[model samples]
Target: MDVSWAAFVGVVVLAYLIPGPDFVVILRSATRGWRTGVAAALGAQTGLCVHVALAVGGLSLVLSRHPDLLTAIRTAGGLYLLYLAGRLVLATFRSAPGPDREEPAPGHGDRSAFGQALFTNLLNPKAVLFFAAVLPEFVGGPAPTWAQVSILGALDVLLGLVAWSVVILAGARLGRLLSRDRVRRWWDRTTGATLGVLGGGLLLARD
Candidate 1:
């Protein structure tokens, strides 16, 4: 696989534009608080990196060998999305206060956020499929597979982090315009609905 800088950048751009769990989580977190948003972003990226590693290491090979398991994973991922969506929608009607409803109340307890982000991404089997399918496109035969995967993994983390950070920063800015409670409620509902739609979409997807 020959490495073209332009092609690589294009792939990254496209991935950024593609709507998925990472984007939804980042937007939700950022609007809530920078710490949570960054945490979720880093967490999701960590998961992506892990999936890339697994793909390069040929864990996907095992998965491929077991089509039933793969299907189960896909199903689970879809269900998880639905569950998250339901949670969000339920929260929309609740008087409860979650991270989203909170203010810019400062404190960079980013470790927790990072862990949550990482867990969400890691648990997402769709991300695993994504790495299996998309990661190989960037590599050439002469290049060490691990080396190519490493580069791609690094790119995934960097691009994903940067993209989510920008989103969060922008949300933070917009956050100042609305009352904390209103912003929180609006984002919660929006995220809940978005997650629901995404979940349903995922269920309907085939690949």
Candidate 2:
């Protein structure tokens, strides 16, 4: 295969090592149930498909040429993150759960988790930027750029799914400890605050 995938694999592995919004969503959902966490992972990866499609279609290059477009996207994504954070924070104020609320069954709130995870990943401009800027450098094969990017981007998403599954497995084990009302309250608060910070950083960051 002419695809220079060694460096690309290295990048993907490094990315898996780092934590991002997806990580927070999966682990949080797992606190509800491992099944919920799996749904969240699916939604997140589906959102990743949009970014990959954009990169494969060369829309990323267009966005790069027009910084304003990217800025607009980044702003929207940041605002969305802020909105999710606000909701999480407000939820903390609600009447507390019993000592250990039974871990939710598979169907309960799984759809909601998936929806939230999908949008969280879909709206982030940084993802497309990575696909546009970093992905191209790794495309050295004589094949069409679109073809190469499709394969490379697909690999990234596949690896992401595997990584999230591993996280979900670990988080399911931790979910037992986190199920206590007091701990969950604090956990939600911390995740909310972190999301707020990330959103603010995105909005303030210069191109």
Candidate 3:
């Protein structure tokens, strides 16, 4: 294909760099341990794969053509974000060991985190729209549209993984700081507020 490799890479890199719910989720998981952090990142990427599949199979086009379907997805996504926010806020009030206590080793939490991150990405209508709007830009080269789109989608996933790995690793380094009960409580409230704001923004978003 005659894709603009440099341009595509630059755009994708910049997009991944912009922190969002995905970043928040990964960062929060990182506070638990490397395994949870990686699981969260993988789950998010896996959700992106679903979007890519939908885009490739023309499902995204169908959704784009049907405003109702798009609206439904967006509403669900927004509500889910609100639910997540509520959970985070509630976490701040839950009883837990003091910060000085030894941190628990990561376990089943990683599995649930993977699912949470996966659904978080999947429910995001913006991500679906992103694939629909941006993938086509690189589809008119030597290769067929499907092939080009597939390649671009793969690249997006790869870059996303790489970018999130950095976030997870860096956040892991700060795990000790985050483990502090006071700091953790503050972080939970802050993140909860951020999620609530984002949910509200998405709920009011227009097509």
Candidate 4:
């Protein structure tokens, strides 16, 4: 693998700093549990692989030729982010206040957790399109594209896992102490606001 280590590091670092569906989903999972948190992270990363593959497979070439199309995709992604944020905000207000109100258990073990995580990632259009745009910049050719895509994809997953793990651990600790509806609602509102900001920023991004 003749990959550029510096380029790889830059990509990983930039990706970790950027706000995306994976970040939100992982944060959501962490507050729930390690099982669900890990599941959602892996699932979301797997979906990201699909996006990278599609981008490197030839779709990126088309996008490069037609920046307008890429812009359109990004616009749609921004809309999706707004929708997700809106849902979270709505959930915050509608949730009943009580100690009995708890997040549903994520299920038995790693398998269930992984499935839930995967489903959430695959369902998020913003995640898919975000990867489509970003990964292509790193992998800009058709030569040995699959191998290149795999390398970048691996780095992305690794970095995401590292970042998400920290979030999950912190969230789990905090969640244990403050297991109340009011706190949960506040968290939801904060998450919603974060999502909204990310969406707005992405919308303002230039080609």
Candidate-wise lDDT, in order: 0.69, 0.82, 0.82, 0.66
Candidate 3 worst ten-residue window by lDDT? 99-108
Better of 1 and 4 by TM-score: 1
Can you write out model 4's per-residue Cα lDDT over 1-207, one digit (the tens) per residue? 555778767867776677566677577666766766777677777766666667557655675677687677666666766776787787766637455555422232456546545654554445555565666556655568667777777777787778878877876786676566677677877877887786676689885
Error of 3 at 21 (Å): 1.1
Regarding lDDT, does 1 or 3 come out ahead? 3
lDDT of 3 at 83: 89
Better of 1 and 3 by TM-score: 3
* lDDT comparing candidate 2 with the true structure: 0.82
CA deviation > 4 Å runs, candidate 2: 98-108
Give the Cα RMSD of candidate 4: 4.5
Q: Which wins on lDDT, candidate 1 or candidate 4?
A: 1
Across 33-115, the per-residue lDDT of candidate 2 in tens digits comes to: 88999999999999999888988889766976897988888898889888878888778877775646642222237898899
Error of 4 at 120 (Å): 8.3
lDDT of 4 at 183: 76
**Tens-digit lDDT string for candidate 1 (20-46):** 776776766666567777777777877
- TM-scores for all candidates: the values are 0.81, 0.91, 0.91, 0.73
Where does candidate 3 stray beyond 4 Å? 96-108
Residue runs of model 1 more than 4 Å from their true location after superposition? 96-116, 123-126, 180-183
Instruction: Sort every candidate by lDDT, greatest first.
Output: 3, 2, 1, 4
Clashing pairs in 3: none
Model 3: per-residue lDDT, tens digit, 1-207? 888899999998988888888888888888778999999999999999999988888865786688688788788888988988888787667667655764332222889779878988998887887888877877785677777788899999999999998998897898878756778778778877888888888899987
lDDT-best of 3 and 4: 3
